[model samples]
Target: MPCLPHELIAWKILVRLPTKSLLQLRCVCKAWRDIISGADPSFSQAHLDHLHQQVKKPYSLLIAPRIKSESDMEDPRDTRRPWADMKVTSPGLYLWEESQKDIATLLFDISSFPAEGAATRHGLTHCDGLVFLPAEDTVRVLNPATRQIRVLPWSLNSVAPRRCPQGEGHQAFGFGRDHRSNAYKVARFFHRETRGMGGLGMEVFTIGKDQCWRETAVQPPYPFVAGLTATFFKGSLIWTIDYYSPMYDYSHLDDAANMPCFVRFNLEDESFSVMTGPPWYKGPTILTPTLPR
Candidate 1:
């Protein structure tokens, strides 16, 4: 009987082992299987967060090269060498470089690039070792360490294109890790016609049970005056907006008075507010927030 209790204790420790070791322990016994896969939300979330933090490392962001000349082909394969040649050394930023294989590969560190399965050629945003890819209507969340990808189903308003056809309107995305809930949140925004200048609207989506997505109510008082950039920060998706006057034509920017203003999104409250830039900074700038370790 004493031996049985000791064996049980050993199994308990085994189940909580790292992912690779846990996979091996799954074959030890049926009891081990049940214990390891039990529906303990807290335990599961802790394990996931542990795994995510363990592999968090600096990543490079690679952009697809634009074809500027007649010889430039739409096929990424045609200009692979140049894409592969481009690299960025910034820490905590995920970089994607075009590869000879015609796919954008994410290069971490200075070594090899991990091959990501059939990925859409879209813009990528990185946070806490997770890469958010906005591909048309779908957003994919990928873990570069494990090479696992999950597609998030989100409803995007089609009216955005029709309304802002000339200026490419605004699309903002925020990604963050929620320590309290042990879940990750991805939020996107599409501007709508509202009572404000030139009329603007906002929409939000959050991850729900079963790894699904749920749309939230439209947030009023859009964040930006002109352009939008969404990023994950401080356990919430943050939208950074640049302000502009409704009557001011962009062409008149040469006159210093036509400068852009700023706004921000508070994910927790689903609210909007003005964002003041750093005191010493001037001109157009992009801000990306770092998640707390």
Candidate 2:
């Protein structure tokens, strides 16, 4: 294998390459391929740990315009969409540094995204540098820096049990890394009509490998509020629901609303568990996970 310039030989420099370029580099030679692939679990972990010890700083923000179907631009298919300002459309993906500096650089067009007939109204979820853009009927996983994309299988909600009259449920999405296998995963949840309004449907997609969605077990105790965002933290996806809402029929059980709980789905194990929420939490409230100092 030919030697790379001393500067380019470093793993740190190579890891910074955009997704496409890094992949292209793999074709350069056997040596380059090994270096790129080696950075996966072992090298990547050490590098990130070193960075955490340094002074903390604000990172870039993932910005996309509000979910507006008519306003989504699928035509001009440019990465940066330099002429985007001309059309009264929406804001494309860009990075914002401290003091609101615009980096109109990365081209992350999910249209023709993970599927053919482009999905619309992207709901973005970010974790460990992978951004999940959930569209109408499809879900796209992307590394904006790497320029890599993964599209998930279509939702089987249409054919799943209790298709008609969806039984007053909400859709939630969680994206995070499964430390056990060192792979990224996406977890989606929603409610299906069943006895006692306790049945919840869950489907999981492992990025880059799984081609289809696999259903899992869920017996929810609260009524899910539709359109509420799901958060990913510590390998678990958490969703907030209304425990006392009229939407939940409580005749068969005790006061369902009296105990508000968090429906947590662990990505690696692919299991659902319920835990007692904060004592202050009485009704539905927005919840997100964060690292402690």
Candidate 3:
């Protein structure tokens, strides 16, 4: 059989396949693997672009469930009980595809990624086929398609959750690719309190490149409420402003004060900007209008 040109194989035929299939095809030979696994930046971007264009659902929904061990004696979430101290045993990541709307396919198990103590919260973030799993101190970058896991360096700024549930400090995370540098980056907002001193700051870490978390010159305009995942869109990470309180205090506020506002951090320039929230009618509605006078 006449051998196909590299362009025809890589660009035309290979780019058409989904990421999972492409990863598996890597074992076919070293040459094909290089093309599929991002040896060529253009090919990598082209494949991602192809996936976005062809699949209505460009990204997979990664579900990281906090499964409590059977031996857990108390519920950490119980307000009445003392800090349960029950460890969060996440059962690894599950992938939900558009084709399988009703079922979520398990990709990797907990044993695949090991960690000490509680490793994850309830949320997961995805961008360009990569899943970002943020833990207490370390952030893991997982390619569900390839089942490749890259654990990043522990951040000194990350404040470990306290024995009491409320002691969990304020922190939010986002992950995305910087088009200019062609590198994946993780951004975070944190307010660490110790010795009666609290400080708000932002940090960025470029995967496979940065040895440590670099504090960004741009700080978050508003404090981001913890437990809320930042959305990565168009080369930026955006988070809703926690106007009411920085310590996850959601109570004692009227409806008008509860409306959400956003702050955006650009990956390329490492700049922060405010984004307006959706238009909401703030005027009170008259229960019954006088019949047109």
The candidate that wins on TM-score is 3
User: Which regions of candidate 2 fall more than 4 Å away from where they truly are?
Assistant: 1-30, 37-53, 67-91, 99-122, 159-170, 193-198, 217-223, 244-247, 250-258, 284-293
Best by lDDT: 3
| Per-residue lDDT of model 3, residues 1-293, tens digit only | 99998778998999888777887899988899889877787898888778668635534467777755655545556565333355556677787877787888887775535533442452567787678887666678888677678888878877667632236545778888898987899988887573211356889999878999999976666676565667777888777666545334434434642243677789999998875454562422211111110
Q: What is the alpha-carbon lDDT for the whole of candidate 3? A: 0.69
Worst 10 residues of 2 by lDDT: 113-122
Query: Candidate 3: TM-score?
Result: 0.77
List candidate 3 stretches off by more than 4 Å: 55-60, 73-84, 111-122, 162-166, 194-198, 244-260, 281-293
RMSD of each: 8.7, 7.5, 7.6
Query: lDDT per model, in order?
Result: 0.48, 0.58, 0.69
- For candidate 3, the clash count comes to 0
lDDT of 1 at 291: 33
What is the Cα-based lDDT of residue 16 in candidate 3?
88
Write down the TM-score for model 2: 0.67
Error of 3 at 220 (Å): 1.8
